[model samples]
Target: MDRVFSFQASGVCINTQHHLDALCVYFSDRDQLDSLEFYSDLEASLKSAVLLPDCVVMIASRKFCEDIKEYWSNDVLKASFVTRGERSGKPFIKYYYLYCWETSGLVEVFSHCADADVKPCFNLSICDLVQQGLYHLVKENNVVQIAPVGHLFKHPSGTRNNIFIQARELAKTEPELCFVGRSISLAFGFERFAKLSVVYIDSMGIYHFVQEALSFCKVDARIHSFHSYDEMRKLTPPPIEHLIVISASTSGGMARDLRNDQGFSDSRILTLIDKSDSDRSGKVLIALESVDKNIFDFEADNFETEIELVGEHFSSKAKPPRAVTLGRPHTPPKLLKFLKEFGRDGLNSLNEIIDGQPKVLSLVTEKVSRNKVFLKWLEEEVSWNITVAIDTVICTDDLGSIEIANTVADLISTHKVGSARPTVCVYRNVDWSSVSNATGVLVVTAVARDGGLLREISRDLRENLNSEINCPRHYLTAVGLPQSKETWSRLKQFLERNASERLYGFSEWLVLPIGSDRQSNHWSDLAALAKTSQVVEVESSVVSKSVVDASLDLVSDAIRKGFNGFLPKTDGSDLALSSGFIYFGDVFKDDLESALHATSYLAIASALQKARDIDDVANQLRSTGYESVILSPECFLRFNDNILHACILRGCRKGELDYSSSPHHSKLMGEFLLKVFSRHQLPYGAAAVEFAAALATQRLKLKKNDQERLVGKVVNSLKDEPSALLGLLLMVDLPRVSMLSIK
Candidate 1:
C-alpha cells in the first residue's frame, strides 16, 4: 500500500531543491473564471506562461473565491507549484511551491505587493517618481532621493523606516478616508486626517445633534455610523452616496464594530466595539475600502431589522447564524457536563455487570431442593395479560401454547431485514432460530393428534432442532412438572407440526429451536416426562414436508414490494429521491461526494420504512434489496442495530499489502477508486475500499525518499482483507503519474 489511512500516512515528503531562479508572476488586467472544462484561464497561461520555469504565479480573481467556495465541501487546498530546474554545476532541484494566494500577483507587480487603493504606483503623487523604477536602501539620517526624471533634491519625506512621510503640507489632497465626531475612530483613538472637517459625535445623539454639528462645520463631514435604532429611525435618508453608519456599539451589534478605516466603499460605517469579547459585543466591522453604495439601503431600510430577527432566532435555536458569520460550538457546557457525568464511571470499573450466554438449546434433568422449586397452585393462578390471548384460549393445550410462541417467533423471523440473525434460548442446550415470513401458522397442534402418535413426531423434531443452526434457540419445555395429560398431548402435537414444516416429506435439513424467554435452570424438568431427554430419539433419518411453494409465493409478493420500494410508483413529479439513492449507492461512484452518498443511502432506508401493511420489521429487513460494501465507523456505531462493523485484515507480502483477501472484483474497483482519493480531500478512518485506494494515489505524490515511511504508517492503520489489500497495493504501481503528451 502506498498509503491508506489519512492520519497515519500523511507525513512523507521529498525535499527538492530550488527549481527556478526568479519568480515569474503572471497577472492579467481582466478577471478570469475557474471552470470544469478548463482548470482556469491560467491553463493556457501555463503553456507560454512560464518563461521562468523556476517560479510561477497565476493571477486569480473574485471568481476564484466564488467557485472554490461553492464546490469545496471537505477542505480547501492551498495551491502548489511543481518545478524541475538545474543550476549550472549544481544538482537538479525538483519541488513544488505551496502558500497563500492573498498576497501574490498584485504585490509582485513591483518590489512590494501593490496596495489596491494606491493605483499605478504609491509614489505617483510626486511627478518625478511617477515614470521611473528606483530602489532605495538608505540609512535613517543620511538621506537621499534620486528620481529617474529629476535632479537629486532633499527627500521631502523624512523617516528612518521602510517609507517616510513629512505631512506638514497636510492639506493638499482631500482625505477620502475619514472619520467624524462622537463616532470616534476605533483605532489610534480619534480620526487624525487633517482634511477631516465635519464630524458627528455619536449615532446615539445624532437625531438630536446632527443639524447643530453640520451648521458649525465648513465642509459637511459625512456621517459614518448609526448607533441607536431610534436615532436611525428619525433621520431623513441621506443623499444616495456610499455612507458609513456605526449603527451600534461593540457592546450591542454584530456588524457594528469597525476596527479600521480601510473599507473600500466611497462611504461606509466604522462601528466601535470592545476588541476583547468574541461575540457580537466584542467584534468590529469596518469598511476595507469604501465604494459607491446605495445610501438608502442601510440608513432607512429594513436591513438591520432582518439581521436582528435572524440573530434572535439563532439564539433561541441554540445555534449561531451561519449565513454571514461563524459561531463556535457550545464547548463550555458540554465539557462541564462530561466531567460531572463520568467521574464515577472513570473511578470504578468493577461495579459493572458481566456475564456469558450459552450457544445451544438442549434439555437435562437434575435434582432440585424443595425450596428451590417453583410450585404453583392449580386453581389460584390469576387471570393475567402477561400470557397472550388468541381465539378465546388460555393455551392450556401444549400445541396451542407452541402456536402462540411460534406466532411471536415467526413475527421475529420475518424481521430478518435482510440476513439471518442470532436467536438464543438460555434454558435448553437445543437453542436455535429460523427465518420468519409475513406470519407464523400453527406448525403442529395436539388437537390434531391423539396419544403416542404426537410423541413420535416430536421425538423426531427434537433431534434435528438441536444439531443445526448453532443458535441455542428458545425452548418451551414440559417434563416432570405438573400439566394435564391433555396439555402433554397437545405439546407433542406442536413439536410434530414444526418438524413437518422444516423439510420436504422426502428430505432432511439442519434444525435449531426457536424460543422466547428463560428462567433459571429447569429446562429438562419442564420439557420431559422422565430423566432421559437426550436418549429419547425418534427415527434419525427422517423426511418432513414443508410449504416452500407457499413461502415462494410470499417471496414473489415481496418482490413486488421490493420493486415498489426501489422505484416508487408515484409519478416522476414527486420522485422521493434519485434512482441512485434507491439503489443503496451500489452506484456510489468514485466521483460522488460523501454528503451526496449519505443522503442517498438514508433516502433508501426512509422509503423502505414507508410501505403499506408492513408490520414485521425483521421480515422487511430480510427482503430489503440494498446492501453496503463499506460503512463509516460513525454509521456503524449510530445504526448498530442494522449495520455490521466488518473489517477484513490483510498482511503485506514483501512491500505491498495483499489485495487477494476480498472478492476478485473489488481489485478492479480499487484501481479506479485510488484515483478519486488522490483528487479529493477525504477524511481519515472512513470505511471505504476506495478511501484506501485513493489514499495510495495521494501517497505517490510524496517525496520519493518518504515513500516507505508514509506507506508504513498507513499500513499500520488499516485492517483489510490480505488479497484485497494486496490488489489495492498493486494499483499504486499501475502508472501513478501519466507522462504528458508532447504537443
Candidate 2:
C-alpha cells in the first residue's frame, strides 16, 4: 500500500566506546529473532553464541531462556545480564547484538548498558545463524527480496493473510476537525478552539482547537464538547449558528436546528463527514448578536464582543514571502523586485547562508535549477530554516549502489566517526523488523552480507509511537545494474523496466542532475552536488498557477539541526534533550504550535550558546517573521528576557540602542508574528508602531501617553472589522499613516 507519513530523527549517538557497547548488544538480539536451539549447559551455550549477531545463552538457568522473547526488541543492545548460578554473586552472562556492517574488518561487539568490560566468547555454532550467514541461506532459499519486504506488513503468521491492519487502530486516533464555514477565512480561524477547551476528542479534533484560538486573541472562550450523542444531549446546547462544524457521523436535529433556528437561519455549520472538504479553513469572521455567551464564553465576552479568528500561514518558500502576508493575496512589484535580487544566486539555499554577493553572482552565471531558485528565495525572504536529508551513495561496495537502502534505515543505523559507510549493508546482517514495538521498514539491493536484514528490524519501540497520528514502517529496495558512465546509453531503458515493485519492494527511480553530461551518472552527480554546494533560496509562484513553491523544504536536517527534541521512550514522557531538532512526524503532525515551540527554543538556545556573537544571532534570524507565533520586541522581551540583556550600546543617536552586529531579524520575527496574528489578529497604532520600529531597527519617537493613544487607534480599527491575519499585520503602520497622524 502507498503510505504517507512524517517522521523525525528518533535518536542520535556519539562515536564513543560506551555508545559502541550499547549498539553492539542492540543489533545482536536482532540476529536471534528467527530461531534458537535449547541446550543443557547454559554457560556453554552463551559462550558459544556470544559472537553471533544475537547472544542467546543462559547465565542463571534454563528457565530464563523461554522468557527472553519478552525483552526481544530493536531497542536493547544487551540481551541479558545474570549470575552464573544461584550461589554465584555478580552477574556473568552479558549478551548483546552488534551490527557488523559498520565494522570494515575489525572484531566488534554491541551491548546495552554503558559497562565496557563485557567480553564476547566466540563459537562457530552461533556464527552459522548470523545475518551474514543468513544472506547465504536466503540466496540458497531463492526468497531474498520477498522475505525482507514482508517484514513491514502486519500479518498473523497462523491465521490471517493480507488482512490489512492500519496504524490508526494501534494508537489513539484524533479524527480531523470539521468546522466548515461559508469561506476559507472562517475555517482557518475556528481551528484555534481545540486547545483552548482542552476537550479530549479521541477521534474528532474540533474540541480544544476552538478554545485555544480564542485564548490566542486574549479572549476567554470555552468548548461545551461532548464525545457521544448521549453526552451532548445532556449539556444545555446553544442555538445552532448559521454555519456549524461537526464530524461526519454526527447529523440529524443538531444540524437542522442550526439551519432552521431564526437566530441561526443563515448560519452554515461545517461537518466532517468525508475527505471531500478536507482542506483547513484559515480565516473566519463570526457575528455575535447576543449577550448570552454562555454558549461560548460561560462568564466573559458578552454580546459586546465580536470574535474574529485568523491563522498563521505563508506560501511554500516564495520569494519576497512578505509580499504575500495574511493581509492581502496579491504579490506586489516591490516584493518581486526583492525576489529578483535574492535569486541572483543559483544554489538551493533554503535555510543556508551565502557570503559575499560576488560568489553568489558567479553561481547564477554557471547554471540554475528551479529548486535552487526557490530555496534561495525562501532563505532570503522568510525567517525559516530548511532541512533535507537525502539518501546518496558516496561509497558503494555491498550492493548495486543503493545508498537509499542505508539512508532509509537511519532509525536503525549507527553513525560512527572514522568509519566507512557502504552503499548497502548485508541483507539480514543488519536488518531486523518488528522490534521495539513500533512498525519498522528496510530496503536492500542484490548484493549480500548475511546479517544486514536482521539489523534493520525496529518495530519494537521504546515507547509506542504517538496514537494521534498514523505512520507505518516500510522497506524498499531498488534493483538495477551498477550506475556508471558505461550504462548511460541504456539508462532510461533500464530504469523503465526496473521501476516495478513486482521485482523489488518500492517505486524505483533514479534522480539525475539536470546539467549532467551523461544520464546514468544523474544520481551520483546530484548527490555529490547537494552534499557540498552552498544552497541559495529563490522566489517564484508555482509554474502552473498560484500554489506553494516546489522547493519548499518541508523537512530538512539543515533547518532542524540543533534544538531540544521530544522522543517517546518506554518511560513515556518525552525524553527531552538538546538533540538538534529531531522531528518525529509519525508521532506528531508539525503544525504552527509545534513550529513556535521549536523556533522559540532554538532562538533561545542559539542566543545562550554564543552570547557574544550578536552578528551570528542576527544572521541566523535574517529576513522576516512567521504567522504562527508573535515575536515582537515586547513578546520576545517578555518571553526570553533572561537571555537578552538590555541593549546597553547606544546607537549614533541618543535613545537608539545599537548592537555590535545587526539586530534586525525580520524573517524570524515575521514567522513568529504571522502565526500569532493568524490566530489573534492584534491591531496596530502605538504597540504596532513600536514593533515596526524594531523591524526597521529604529526607536519609537512617540512618548508614553502618545504611544498609548497610537496603539489604541490601531487596535480599535480592528475592534469590529473582520480581516485576514495577514491583512491585520500589513496594516501595522498604515504605510506612513502613523507619521501623518502624529504630524
Off by over 4 Å in 1: 1-243, 246-708, 712-723, 732-743
Question: How much lDDT does each candidate structure score?
Answer: 0.24, 0.25
- State the weakest 10-residue window (summed lDDT) of model 1: 1-10
Error of 2 at 724 (Å): 35
lDDT of 2 by residue, 559-621 (tens): 122112211111122212222222211222333223222232222322321222223322222
- Please name the candidate that would achieve the greatest TM-score relative to the true structure: 2
Estimate TM-scores for all models. 0.16, 0.18
